[model samples]
Target: MDVVIKDRGNIKWTAIMLPEHVAAVKQEIINLEKVNQPLLDEDRLSEIEMLIYEAMEYNLQLEFKLFKKGYIESIIGSTHFIDYIKKEFRIKDKNELTHKIPFQKIVDVQKV
Candidate 1:
């Protein structure tokens, strides 16, 4: 005759953890999943700026890749507002929702 054992994984430890401890462990896992923002070279930045200007001048829809809170996000829209003083620009998406994005957060831009 032989005996077998089973692994319960997180289910077993969760029962012994307090609510706060469980929450902290969950938060730590989320933090670990996050990534660092990428750095763009000057040439790439200039290209993105050019694309933004071309899209705005020709009234074309464009897609932008942005870095936010250690995550990469993609947005498709047309230029809405450009604030030179604040160094941030706004875009109006298909739903007519406007989003303000900073230049530093910009990763890549493309005409769509």
Candidate 2:
């Protein structure tokens, strides 16, 4: 993972990761949020939101990089990627092994 911090003072950041890595990081963030739910103060909530955004940015970067590398057959939605993996990997059971990522908010990676 390679991240380029855009606005240090403003708390805006960006990161690039492989598609698999993005999936892993997204799962990690979700797990962290679950564990920290009890400590959800204003500041903690803001931190969690930032973590989610950062993970999403990295996912978009992965998509773009894969497109550039010609690894993906076509540009697809993130949800499609999840489905594709499940089908291709023959993952029928959704358990702790499969990190269920929450829906991603729209992120404008082009502007970032």
- Per-candidate TM-scores read 0.83, 0.23
lDDT of 2 at 39: 24
Q: Rate the local accuracy (lDDT) of all candidates.
A: 0.90, 0.34
Q: Residue 21 CA error for candidate 2 (Å)?
A: 48
Candidate 1, residues 1-112, lDDT tens digits: the string is 7977798989899999999999999999899977898889989888888888888898889998899897789999999878999999899999999999998898888888
Among these predictions, the greatest TM-score belongs to 1
Report residue 82 deviation for candidate 1 (angstroms): 2.2
Model 2: residues >4 Å from true position, as ranges? 1-37, 60-97, 101-112
Locate the minimum summed-lDDT window of 10 residues in model 2.
61-70
Candidate 1 least-lDDT 10 residues: 47-56
Q: What RMSD does model 1 have?
A: 2.3
**Once model 2 is optimally superposed onto the true structure by TM-score, how far is the C-alpha of residue 42 displaced, in angstroms?**
1.3
- The TM-score, computed over Cα atoms with residue i paired to residue i, of candidate 1 is 0.83
